[model samples]
Target: MHDQDRKLLQQMFEAAVHAAEPGAAMRPFLPARPAGRVVVVGAGKGAAQMAAALEELWAGPLEGVVVTRYGFGVATRGIRVLEAAHPVPDAAGVAASEALFAAVEGLGPDDLVIALITGGGSALLAAPVAGLGLADEVALNEVLLSSGAPIGAMNALRRILSRVKGGRLAQAAHPARVVSLIVSDVPGDDPAQVASGPTVPGAGGRAAALAAVEQFGIALPERLGSALEQGEEPPRPDDPGFARDEVHVIASGAKSLEAAGAVARAAGFTPVILSDAIEGEAREVAKVHAAIAREVVLRDRPFARPVAILSGGETTVTLRRTGGRGGRNSAFLLSLALEIEGLDGIAAMAADTDGVDGSEDNAGAFADGTSAARIRAAGVDPAAALARDDAWSAFAAVGDLYVTGPTGTNVNDFRVILIR
Candidate 1:
C-alpha cells in the first residue's frame, strides 16, 4: 500500500509539472509576430524552455537573450540562453541582465518585445541599482530567505533594489510593444510579484518595500537602506512606458494543482483540492495539513477514505541556523511525518514543481505513517533533524528523497496527502 501510494504521489507531481510546461502553456499566449524584429528577453528557471518554445512556434526572425539557473538551460536557436545562479545573484547574472537590456535596446515602435518572465527571475536576472553591487543583492537574498517573510514581501523589497526588476526592463524597451508571458509561482499569481515584475509595473513603491523590511526585522545594509530611503521609485502602473505592454499569466500553481487532482481521480482516489495559495512557515503549514489528514482518516469528517488532499503554494522555511540541507518541501514532509507517525492508511508527498527545492538537488521528499519509524530505525533522530532544519538528511537516511532533475518549469510547491 505504501509503495502504491508513493507511486501515485509521483504521478500526480509529474502531471502537475507537465501541465505547466512552457511548450504547452506558452502556445496559446504567444503574441502575433511583428513586421519589425521580435526581441525575446526572459529570466527564470523556465526561461530557457520558454525561449525554446517560442523559437519553435514563431516563424519570424527573433533574437534576444534569456537567463536561467545554471542547470536549467535548454538549447535554443534565435534566443541565446545564459546560465546564472538562483536564489542569489552572481556576476554572471549581472552580465546576463546587461545582455537582456542590450537585446531590447534601440528597438523601434514597430518592433515587439516578448518578455518570458517566471519565478526565480529575481535572482537569475540580477541588475543591482546604483550604489549597490552584486554582492549586495546576494546578501539581500540570503537575508530575505532566512527572514521568514513571504515571497510577496521579499519580492516587494527586491523590486526596489533591482535595476532590471520592477518594470525597469519594460522601461528600458520604451516605444516597443512588450508582451509579458508569465508563469506565476507567487501566492496571489500577481505578475508583479513573480520575478519582481520586470515587465509589469510595481506597486506600493519604496513605502511598501520599507514596510516589509521593518515587518520582517530585516537589517538591510546601511547603503541599501539609504538607497531605499532616497532612491527614485520604480515606474508606476500609469507610466506611459507600459501603455503598449501586455501581461498574461500563462500558468500558475492553481492550474498545476488542478492537473494533479485529475491524476488522483484517475487513480481511483477522490481528490480534494484544499487550496492553491496556501502560505506560512513550512512546518506550520504541515501541521495544518497533518491535522486535516488525521481528521479524514480517523473520523472521515471533511473527506472519506481513498481521498487525496492536494495543495499548491510556495511555503517558506525560516532558517533558525545555518548548515541545513533541505528546502521547504522536504522540511514540510518531515514535519508531516512526525505529526502522523503510527497513523495508518496515510501517505504524502511535497515537492517543488521546478524539480529542485531550495538549493538542494532533490525536488522534495515522501512520508508515510511509518516514515517516522523507518527514519528512527535508520539511526537518525527525526526531531533533532527537524530542529536543525535538516529534513533532507532525515529523508536521505531512509531513501525517501524525491530527486527529479530540473523539470523546465516553475509553479512553486506541489503537495498531496493520501488517506485510505
Candidate 2:
C-alpha cells in the first residue's frame, strides 16, 4: 500500500516538473531567425534540451555553448552543449564557463544573443570575481548553505561576489541584442535573482550583499569579507552594462503545480493547488500544512477528504546543528510526520523538482501519519534528527527518502499533501 502511495506521489511530482520543462515553455518566446549573428549561451539542467528545441525550430546558423549537469547532454547538431557540475562548481565547470564567455566575444549590436537560464546555473557559471578563487566561492557557499538562509539570501551573496553572475554575463555581451529566456526557480520569478541573475541586471551593491550574508548569520572567508567590503561589487542596474537586455520568465511554479494537479485528478484523486510561491522555513511550513490537513480530516474545511494539496516554492532550513543529511523537503516531511503523530489516513510528499534537495542525491521524502512512530520503534528519534537538520538520516532509518538521480530539468520544488 505504501509503495502504491509512493508511486502516485512520485508521478504527481514528475508531472509537475515536466510541465515546466524548458522545451514546453520556451517555444513561444523564441525570436525569429536573426538577420545577423545568432549566438546561444545557456546554463542549467535543461540547457541541452532547450538548445535542441531551439535548434529544431530555427533554421539559421544557431551556434553557442550551454552547460548542463553531468550525463544530461543531448545531441544538438549546431550548438555545443557541455556537461558541467551543479550545486558545486568543479574545474571542468570553471573551464567551460571561461569558454562560454569567450564564445560570445566580438559580437556586434546587429547580433542576437539567446541566453537560456534556469535553476542550478549559478553554480554552473563558476567564474569567480577577480581575487576571489574557486576555493573562496566554495567556502562562501558552504557557509550560506549551513546558515539556513533562504534562496534569495544565498543568491544575493552570490550576485555580489561573482564576476559572471548577476548580469555580468549579459553585460559582457554588450552591444549585442541580448534576450534571456529563463525557466524560473526562485520565488516571484525575480529575473535578477534567478540563477544568480547572470543575464538580468541585479540589485544591491557589495555592501548590500555583505549585509545580507551577515543578516543571515552566514560567515565569509577573511579575504572575501575584505574584498566585499573594499572592492566594487558586481555590475548593478546603475552600471552602463544595463544598456539593452530583455528577460522573459518562460516557466514558473504555478504552471508546474497546475500540471501536477491535472495528473492528480487523472489519477482519481481530487486536486487542490494551495499555492505556487509558498515560502518560509521548512519545518514551520510543514506545521501549518499539518494544521490545514487536520482540519480537512475533522471538519472538511477548504478541502474534503480524498484530496491532494499541492504547492511549489523554495523553502529554507536553518541549520542549528551539524551532521544533518537532508534537503528542505525531507526536513519538511520529517517535521510534518512528527507534528501529525497518531493522525490517521493522511499522506504527504515534498521534493525538489530538480531531483536533488539541499545537496542530497534524493529528490525529497514521503511520509504518512505513522512515519514518526515507525522511526521511533526502529530506535530513531525523529525530533532529535530534525533538530539537528538530519532529516535524511531519520527518513533513511526507515527507508522513506526518495532518490531520483537527475530529472534533467529544474523549477525549484514540488510538494503534495494528500488526505484520505
Candidate 3:
C-alpha cells in the first residue's frame, strides 16, 4: 500500500539528482573559447561526468584528465578518467592531484583550461602544502575526518596547505583563461569551498583555518601549525590569477529542490519546497522537520494535509558521541523518529543524492510512525543506536534503509517529508 509513496520518494530523489547532472546542466553554461588546445582538468564526484559533458559541447580537440571518487567515473573518450578515494584522500588521489597541476603548467594564452570542480574534489584532488609530505597530510586528514568538523571549516584548513587548491590551480594555468564549471555540494554553494575551489580563489584566510583546527580539536602536525601561522593564505578574486578566469555553478541544491518539488507534484502531491539553504546539525534539522510534520498532521497551519516539505543543503553531524557509524542523513532520520514518536500517516526519507552519508554504505534511512515498533521488534534499542550514531544498522534491521551506490552526480542532499 505504501509502496507508491516509496516509489514516488525514490523518483523525487532521482529527479533532483538527474536535474543537476552535468549531462543535462553543463551545456548552457559552457563558454566559447577561441582557437587553442582545450584541456579539461578537474576533480570531484562529478568530475568524470562533467568532463564528459565538456567533451560533448566543447568545440575543438579536447584532451585532459579528471579525477573522481572510486566507482564514480563516467565513460568519456577525450578526457582520461581516474578514480580516487573521497572524503578521505588515497594514493590515487594524491597522484592525480599532482598530475593535474603539472599538466596545466606552461600552457600558452591561447590554451584554455576547463576545470570541472564539484563536490568531493577536496580529497580527490589533494596536494599537500609545501614542506609537508603526503604522509603528514594523510595523518592530519584522519584527525579532521573523525573530528566531525564542518566541510567548509575542514576545507579551509586544506586550502592553506595546498599548492593546487584554493586559487592555486588557476594560478598554475597563468596566462591561459581558466573556466570552472562547478557542481556545488557545500552549504551556500560557495565556489571557493566546492571541491576546495581548485580553479577558484577561495575566501578563506590562514586565521580561519587556525580557528577551525582549534574549534574541532584536531591534532595538527608541526608543519601544519607553522604553515598556518606563516602562510599568507590562498588568493581571492583580487588576486591576479583570477583576473582572466570565470566560474559557473552548473548545479546547486536549490535547483535540485525545485526538481524534487516538481516530481512530487507530478505524483499528485502538492509539493512545497521549503528552502534549499537549510543548514544545521543533521539530527537538529530532523527535529525541525519533525515539528513541521506534526503541524501538518494535526493543525495543517502552514500547509494543508498531505504537505511534502522539501529542502536541500548540506548538514553536519558532530560526533561528540563515541562509536557513531551512521551518516548525517541516517542520523537526521533517526532523530526525526525520536521527536515525532509515532505520528500517524506521516513518513519521510532523507538521503544524499551522491549515494553516501558520512562513511556509511547507505544513502540514508526511512522513518514513519511504525519506526518505534520496528526498532523494538528488531531488538535494537533506538535510543542506544542513536547514541552510537549507528542509525544505518537500526534502519537496516527494520528494512527501511536506502542504498543507491555512487549516483555519478552530486547536487548536495535531498529530503522529503510526506503527510497524507
Candidate 4:
C-alpha cells in the first residue's frame, strides 16, 4: 500500500508538470503568421522547447535564437537554440541575449517577434547593462536567492540592471509587432513579473527595485546603485514601444494544480487544492502544511481519509549556512520530515516542475513514515542535515530523491501530501 501511494503521488506530480508543457500549451496562443518574416526569441527553462513547438505549428519561414537552461535545450529545424546557465547569469547567456537583440533589431512593422517567456528568463536573458559585469550580476543574484526575496522583487532588480529585460526587448523591436507567450511561475501570474517582463511593460520603476533591495539589506554594487539613482527605468506601460505589443499567459501554476487534482480524482482519492499561490520561507511553509496534515489526520474536519492535499507555487529559502546542498523544495521536504515525525499512513513529495531545484540535479525529494527510519538506520542525522541545508545527501541516503531530467517546463514548485 505504501508503494502504491508513492506511485500515485508521483503520477500526480507528473500530471501537473505535463499540463504546463510548452508543446501542449503554446499552440493555441500562437499568433497569426505575419506577412513578413517571423523572428522568434525567448529565454527560460522551456524556451528551446517552446521555440520547437512554434516551429512545428507555423508553416512559414522562421529564423531566431532562443536561450534555455543548459540541459533544457531541444532541437529545432529553423530556430537556433542556445544553452546557458539558469538561476544565475553566465557568459553564454549574456552572449545569447545579445544575439537575440541583434536578431530583432531594425525590424519593420510587417515583421513579427514571437517571444517565449517563462520562469527562468530572468537568468537566461543575462545581458547586463553597461558598467555591470556578468560577475556582478551573478553575485547580486546569489545574494537575492540566499536572501529569500520573492520572485517579484528579484525580477524587479533584474529588470533594472539588464539591457534586455523590462520591456527593453520589446523596445528594441521598435515597429515590429511583439507577441509574448508566457508560462507563469510567479504568484498572481503577473505578465510584468514573468521573466522580468522582457517584452511586457513593468508596473513599477527603480524606486520599487531599490526598496526591495534595501528591505532585504542587500548591498548593491556602486555602479548598480548609481544606475538606480539615475532612474533610467524600464519602459512604462504607456510607452509607445509596447503600443502594438501583446502578452498572453499560455500556462500557469493554477492550471497545473488543477491538472494534479484531476489525477487524484481518477485514482479514487479526494483531492483538496489548498492554494496555487503559496509562498514563504520553505521551512515555514512546510510547518504550515504539517499543521494542516495533522488536522486531517487527527480531526478530519476539513478532509477525511484517503485524501490528497495539493498546492503549487514558488517558495523561497533563506540560507543560514554556507556550502549547503539543496534547493527550496528539498529544504521544504526535509523540514516536513522532521515536522511529521514519522506519522503512519501519510506521505508527501515536493518538487519543482522544471526538474531542477536550486543548483542541484534532482527535481526535489519525498518523505514518508519510513523516511526518518531509513535515515536513522543508515546512521545519518536528519536534524543536522536540515540545519546545514544538506537535504540532498539526507534524502539521497534514503533513496527518496526525486529526479526527472529536464521536463521542458517551469511552473515553479508542486507539492502534494497524501493521507490514508
Candidate 5:
C-alpha cells in the first residue's frame, strides 16, 4: 500500500509539472508578429526553455539573449541562452543582465520586445543599482532567505535594489511595444511579483521596500539600507513609459494544482483542492495540514476516506542557522511525518515544480505513516534533523528524497496528501 501510494503521488506531481511546460503554456499567450524587429529577453529557471519555445512558435525573424540557472539551459537557435546562479546573484548574472539591457537598446516604436519572465529571475537577472555591487546583492539575498520573509516582501525589497527589475527593463526599451509572458510562481498569481517584475511595474515604491525590511526584521548593511532609503523608485504602473507595454500570466500555481487534481481523480480518489496561494513557515503549514488530515481520517467530517488533498504555492523556511540542508518542501514533509507518526492510511508528497528545492539537488521528499519509524530505525533523530534544518539528511537516510534534475519550468511548490 505504501508503494502504491507513492506511485500515485509521483504521477500527480509529474502531471502538475507537465501542465506548466514552457512550450505548451506559452503558445496561447504569444503576441502577433511585430512590424519591426522582435528582440527576446528574459531570466528565470525556465527562461532558456521559454526562449526555445518562442523560437519554434514565432514565424518572424527574432534574436536576443536569456539567462537561466546553470543546469536549466536548453538548445536554442535564434535566442542565445546563458547560464547563471540562482537564489543568489553572481558575476555571471551581472554580465547576462547587462547583455539583456543591451538587447532592447535603440529600438524604434515599431519594434517589439517579447519578455519571457518567470520565477527565479530575481536572482538570475542580477543587475545592482549604482550604489550597490554584486557582493551587496549576494548578501541581501542571503539575509532575505534566512529572514523568513514571504516571497512578495522579499521581491519588493529586490525590486528597489535592482537596476533591471520593477519595470526598469521595459523602461529601457521605451517607445518600443513590450509584451511580457510570465510563468508565475508567487502567491496570488501576480505577474508583477514574479521575478520581481522585470517587465512589469511594482505596486509600491521604495517605502514599501523599506517596510518589508522592517517587517521581516532583516538586518541590512548600513550602506545597503541607506541606498534603499534614498534610491530612485522604479517605474510605476502609471508611468507613461509603460503605456505601450502588455503583460500576460501564461502559467501559474493554480493551473498546476488543477492538473494534479485531475490525476488524483483519475486514480480513483476524490480530489480536494485546498488552495494555491498558501504561504507562511513550512513547518507551521505542515502542522495545519496534519490537523486537517487527522480530522478527515478519524471523523471523516470535512472529507471522507479515499481522498487526495492537494495544494500549490511557495512556502518559505526561516533558517534557524546558516548551513541548513533542505528546502521548504523537504522541511514541510519532515514536520508532517512527525505530526502523523504511526497514523494509518495517510501518505503525502511535497516538491517544487522546478525540480530543485532550495539549493539542494532534491525536489522534495515523501512521507507516510511509517516514515517516522523508518527514519528512527535508520539511526537518525528526526527531531534533531528538523531543529537543525537538515530534513534532507533524514529523508536521505530513509531513501525518500525526490530528485528530478531541472524540469525547465517553475510554477512553485506542489503538495498532496492522500488518505484512505
Candidate 6:
C-alpha cells in the first residue's frame, strides 16, 4: 500500500513539473520573428531550456548568451549557453552577465532583445554593483539565505546590489525593444520579483532593501551596507528605460498545480488545489497542511477521503542550528511526518519543481504512514533532525530522498497530501 501511494504521488509530481517545462510551455508565448537583430539573453534555472525552446521556434537569425545554474545547460546553436553557480553568485555568472550586456550593445529601436527570465536569475545574472565585489555579494546572499527572509525581501536586497538586475539590464539595452519571457517562481507572479526583474521594472528602491536587511537582522558587510545606504536606488516602475520592454509570465506554480490536479483526478482521487501562493517557514507550512489532512481524514469537513491536496509556491527556512543538510521540500516533509504521527491512510510528498531542493541533489522526499517509524528504527530521531534543520539526513536515513537530478526548470516548491 505504501509503495502504491508513493508511486501515485511521484506521478502527480512529475505531471506538475512536466507542465512547466520551457520547451512546451514557452513556444506559444514566443514573439513573432524580429524585424532586426534578435539579441537573446537569459538567466535562471530554466534559461537554457527556454533558449532551446526559442531556438526551436525562432526561424530568424539570432545570437546571444544565457547563463544557467551549473549542470542545467543544454546544447544550443547560435545562442551561447553558459553554466554558472546558483543560490549564490560566482565569478562565472559575473562574466556571463557582462557578455549578455554586450550582446545588446549597439542595438537600435528596430532591434529586439528577447530576455528569458526565471527563478534563480538573480543569482545567475550576478553583476555586483560598482562599489561591491563578487565576494561581497556572495557574503550578502549567504546572510539572506540563512536569515529566513522571504524571497521578495531577499530579492529586493539583491536588486540594490546588482548592476544587471532590477531593471538595469533593460536600461542598458536602451532603444532596443526588449521582450521578456519569464517562468514565475514567486507568489503573486510579480515579474519584477522573479529574477530581480532584470528586464521588468522594479518597485522597491534602496530604502526597501535597507529595510529588509534590518528586518532580517542580516549583518551586511561594512562595504556592502555602505553601498546600499549611499548608492543610487534601482530603477523604478515609471523608468522610461522600460518603455520598449514587454514582460510575460509564461509558466508559474499555479499552472503546475493545475496539472498535478488533473493527474490526481485521473487516478480516482479528488484533487483540491489549496493554493499556488502558499508561503511561510517550511516546517510551519507543513504543520498547517498536516492539520488539513487530519481534518479530512478524521472529520471529512473540508473534503472527502481519496482526495489529494496540492500546493505550490516557495517556502523559506530559517536556520536556527547549523550543520543540518536539507532543502525546503525535504524539511517540509520531515515536519509533516512528525505532525501526522504515523496516521494511517495518509501520504505526502514535497519537492521543488526545479528538481533540486535546498542545494541538495534530491528534488524532495516522500512521507507516508511508515516514514517516521522507519527513521526512528534507523536510529535517527525525527524531532532532533528537525531541530537541527537537517531534514535531508533524516530522509536519507529512511531511504526516502526523492532525487530527480536537474529538471531544467524551476517554479519553486510543489507539495501534495493524499488522504485515503
Which parts of model 1 have CA positions greater than 4 angstroms off? Answer: none
Task: Estimate, for each residue in 1-420, the C-alpha lDDT of model 1 and write its tens digit.
Answer: 377888999999999999898888988888887778889999999999999998988877889999999989998987899999987789999999999999989999999999998888988887888988988888888888888998878877777888888888999998899999999998879898898888888677889989998888988878888878887788898887788889999999999999999999998899999888999999999999999998988899789889999998888888987787899999999999999998999989999999898899999999999999999999999988999999999999999999999999999999999888
- Cα lDDT for residue 329, candidate 4: 95
lDDT of 3 at 389: 76
- lDDT of every predicted structure (CA atoms): 0.90, 0.83, 0.82, 0.87, 0.91, 0.88
Instruction: Write the number of the candidate with greater TM-score, choosing between 1 and 6.
Output: 1
Backbone clash numbers for all candidates listed: 0, 0, 0, 0, 0, 0
If scored against the real structure, what TM-score would every candidate get? 0.98, 0.93, 0.95, 0.97, 0.99, 0.98
lDDT of 3 by residue, 160-248 (tens): 88878888888888789998888888778888888778888767688889888888786786877887787666887688757778888
Name model 6 segments beyond 4 Å from true: none
Against the true structure, candidate 3 has what lDDT?
Answer: 0.82
lDDT of 6 by residue, 1-420 (tens): 278888999998888889888888888777776667889989999899889888988888889999999999999988999989988889998899999889888899888899998898887887888878889878887888888888888878878878888888888887988999999999989999998888886788888888888887887878988888877788888877677678889899999999999998998999999899988899999999999998988899689989999998888898889789988899899999999985889988999988889788999998976788889999999999999999999999978999988887888899999888
Instruction: List runs of model 4 lying over 4 Å from the truth.
Output: none
Q: Rank the candidates by lDDT, best first.
A: 5, 1, 6, 4, 2, 3
Candidate 4 accuracy as TM-score: 0.97
Question: 5 or 6: which has the higher TM-score?
Answer: 5
**Which pairs clash inside model 2?**
none
Best by lDDT: 5
Residue pairs in candidate 6 whose N, alpha carbon or C atoms collide under 3 angstroms: none
lDDT of 4 by residue, 83-114 (tens): 88887788998899888999998899999999
lDDT of 5 by residue, 135-230 (tens): 999988888888989988887888888999988989998789999999999999999899989999989888898888888899998878888988
- In candidate 3, what residue range of length 10 has the lowest lDDT sum? 315-324
Instruction: Give me candidate 3's TM-score against the actual structure.
Output: 0.95
Model 6 TM-score, 2 decimals = 0.98
